[model samples]
Target: MAYVLVLNSGSSSVKFQLVDPAGEATDAPLVSGLVEQVGEPMGAVSVTVGGQEHREELEIPTHSFGLERAFAIMGEHNVGPTDVEVIAVGHRVVHGGKLFSEPQLIVDEIESMIEDLIPLAPLHNPANLDGIRVARAMLPDIPHVAVFDTAFFNHIPPAAALYAINSEVASQYDVRRYGFHGTSHEFVSQQVPKLLDKDPATVNQITLHLGNGASAAAIRHGRPIDTSMGLTPLAGLAMGTRCGDIDPGIIFHLVRQAGMSIDEIDNLLNKQSGVKGIAGVNDFRLLRQRIEEQDQDAWLAYNIYIHQLRRFIGSYMIALGRVDAITFTAGVGENDTEVRQDALYNLDMYGIHFDKEANLVRSKEPRMISTADSPVKVFVVPTNEELAIAQKSAAVAAQARAEGLY
Candidate 1:
């Protein structure tokens, strides 16, 4: 049986999954591992197999070197590089900039396309490109497929997506809204119809992906009509370290009135703002602990984050009328019980009924937490982005083989 390798490379870490397509499996990863602190002196590597996990610390300086060492370790465990006929490599390319509406194999033209969008996604695309280049050099014979996070929102209507001013500037620089988290949104959108046993073309719903980086999408009949993120990841709900939805005038105000440099403002917004800006730390786990201990700043920060999130959710709920259901997925949405319950508590007026018992139960499955008589259903569906990548890669690889193109 052939195996598909999915690689999600970040600036300082990499996540890999080995998947067996033909086996009697349920789309779960066969084996998974992560290498963290790639360029740091005290780096670490960890892998899990057959319900067991392991970790080790070592010195590593780059993604390529860490990947080479990871493969060697895989060999030691008998799941070596040659154990399966690696049909293709699927990568998570963060920003496709309207260039890639579908998955495409790596070639000179595609590489050029990625390079062109570097300025728009400065912090993300470069690390993605580095991974692609290193993978090409290591496995010259394997097909590499690029899946994008912006492709799913390419269908957003012009009126909903267009800005109110500066048509010329927007046209020249592609400054219009281009949503992120397309892969996660698409995965959950498709999963909804399957869970409801209905045709995907006939269902309409809203999905909230609330993780460290959060975004929401409104889907009507399987197409994205609107999304929370706009032009960049910084436009949506507040993130772990990002100050989302700030007034545009603040940038100039800080420079002119406060005598702050552009870099200083940038750092303040991207690193020191959001929950951290209010409470002096970014991690929600610790933030919650502080709030429980009666820390006033922590209480204020927590309530502020929830208020922003509730505002967005109420807006999307109105936009997508006659909503079939609402989905909560990703880290914060799935695991944080208090956050989820608090966000949904006062929405009973909007045809939403909250079940206290159901909402308290936590599991790694698609679960319905709304009351039986509620007009709109609320569910917690775990996001499987890596498995979605593997499925798409397998289909594309099979097509390439049948056409004698690879």
Candidate 2:
């Protein structure tokens, strides 16, 4: 089978999956693994193949060492890149800026362009670049493709994309709402039309990608009308540890009154806020347990999370005018029935009728959870970003081959 190696590299960890090119979106990867704690004193690596798992704890000093050991483990299972027909390596690049609206075959110039975008994604792009460089060196013979997370919503209308700040200043710094989690939103939104059996260009969707890191997108037809995320992932919904939407004046207040540095404030809002900031726990399961135990803080966190979610949902409903479907994907949206129920609670006036029993049913496959006769449908579609990236990478690689670019 022809497989695409999909890699999502963060600052300290790498998530890798070997995806069959012809696999369904919901299909499990042929092999999956994680190389964690890179450059740390004690690191761990694990690979799962054919429902079997093996893990090792050692110093994963660099991206190269970590990945090499991961592939080595897969080799022991006789499913390594060398043993299989690996066609391309797909990379999850966080910020493509405005330059990339689609996946591109990785070339030196492409890598350089990605590097140039590092300033826009200081925390994510560097690690992504490191992984790309290391993977390219390790698998020099195969095609490498950069699948951007922001590419899907790159064309959001000017009103939605621009910040109301000085246009000159915004232009100078490239400040605009370049939505994150585009891969998930795009993948899920496409499935909405298919499920409704409506034409892709005629469907309107509000996709809520609720996970540790959550974001919402309002897609009119196939194009994004607006999205919750802005220039950075920190601007969207209150996530596991993100502050989400907040007044800009608060930054000035913190600097002037609290004497906090920019980096400290950045860490605070991005790592110390959100559900974690209020409930002292970011995991939805833990927060739910606390709520069951009558913890007031947990209740507040849940309320804030749901409140912000409902606000966005309502706004998108208005933006679309005639809504077709409301989709909930990612972790929290898929598994947490309470969140799903509460997010759409009392929206019957908006032509949405949530099915209580249907919402309770849990499965990995994409399924609808709204009344059959409701004008607006609600669904819990699983977002398969790895599969999307792998498929895009395969297509881009094939295109490159046809054009003799490789």
Candidate 3:
């Protein structure tokens, strides 16, 4: 079967999936794998195909070698990278900056533009570039497309996009709200209207993408007006490893009184300040267990997460004015019953009525967890970013072919 190889490359890991471009949004990948600890002496590889998982630990010297080895493992399962025809390649680029708002056919100039925006996403864009370069080199015959995480929020109004800082510096550094996890947000928001049995064009929704990395988007009539994430992914709701919204003075205090360097402060806020920093663990399941065990720190972390989430929900409700649905998506949002329940609770005055039993019933399919009498609907819609990438990549490649760009 022809498939699109979707790659989401991180600094220390590379995740890949072989997706059928024509498949349903809820369809699973034909093959999937993750290569972790790239360039490390001891690395691990995990591949899943046809319901079985194969894992091993080795010295994965480079991204290229790791991916080739993963493909070899897939070959044993009869769906190697080269075993079947690869129609196109889809890459997840974290930051598109101001240049790209839609999926782009990966040409040399496109790659250059992506590279140019690396500073905006220093931790992500370079690794994304690495995946694009390596995949293009490995399969030079097929078209490669880049689907950016920030592309969906590119059209946000300037008021919501810009910060109150010096305009010159902000423009010089391309600093403004870009909103990450946009592929997931866009895909999930599109699915909401279907569940509501309404036209996509008229739906006003608030989609909370809660996971290890979470963000909220206020989508009005199918376009994002404001999102929780700002110029960086670190600016939104408190995430697993990120502090989310914190006072700028805290950074100053850390620098002046705590004697922390800029890099040290960056590391503190980005890696050590979220739910993990407070509870000593990042996984929601573990955090929930701790909360049930009456761990004060874990309880505080959970309250912080919910408080921040509710703040966004309230603000978004005001921003959208007429809200249709509020969707809980991604990892924690889709599966966690209490998190979903607590997020929209006690809002009877504001047209939100949470159904306790419905929220507790877990399923992969999109399900509404709101009462019938409520004006605003609440849903738990599972997100499928890989399939979104495949469909987007296929469309971009098809467009390029029609325009004779390839």
Q: What is the C-alpha lDDT of each candidate?
A: 0.84, 0.95, 0.92
Model 3, which residues run further than 4 Å from truth? none
Q: Residue 13 CA error for candidate 2 (Å)?
A: 1.1
* Deviating ranges (above 4 Å) for candidate 2: none
lDDT of 3 by residue, 1-406 (tens): 7799999998888999999989887788898899999999899989999878999899998888888889889888889877887888999999999898999999999999999998898889999999889888888888999999999999999999999999999988888888989999999999999999999999999999999999999999899999998888999899999999999999999899989999999999999989999999999999989998999999999999999999999999999999999999999998889898888879989999988988889689889999988899999999999999999999988888798876
Against the true structure, candidate 2 has what lDDT?
0.95
Most lDDT-accurate candidate: 2
Clashing pairs in 1: none
Write one digit per residue (lDDT tens) for candidate 1, span 253-334. 9999999998898788878888888898777789889988999999888788888888888887778777888899988888
> How many residue pairs clash in each candidate at the backbone level?
0, 0, 0
Give candidate 3's total backbone clashes. Answer: 0
* Candidate 3 lowest-lDDT run of ten: 77-86
Q: Rank the candidate models, highest lDDT first.
A: 2, 3, 1
**Alpha-carbon lDDT of model 3:** 0.92
Error of 1 at 216 (Å): 0.8
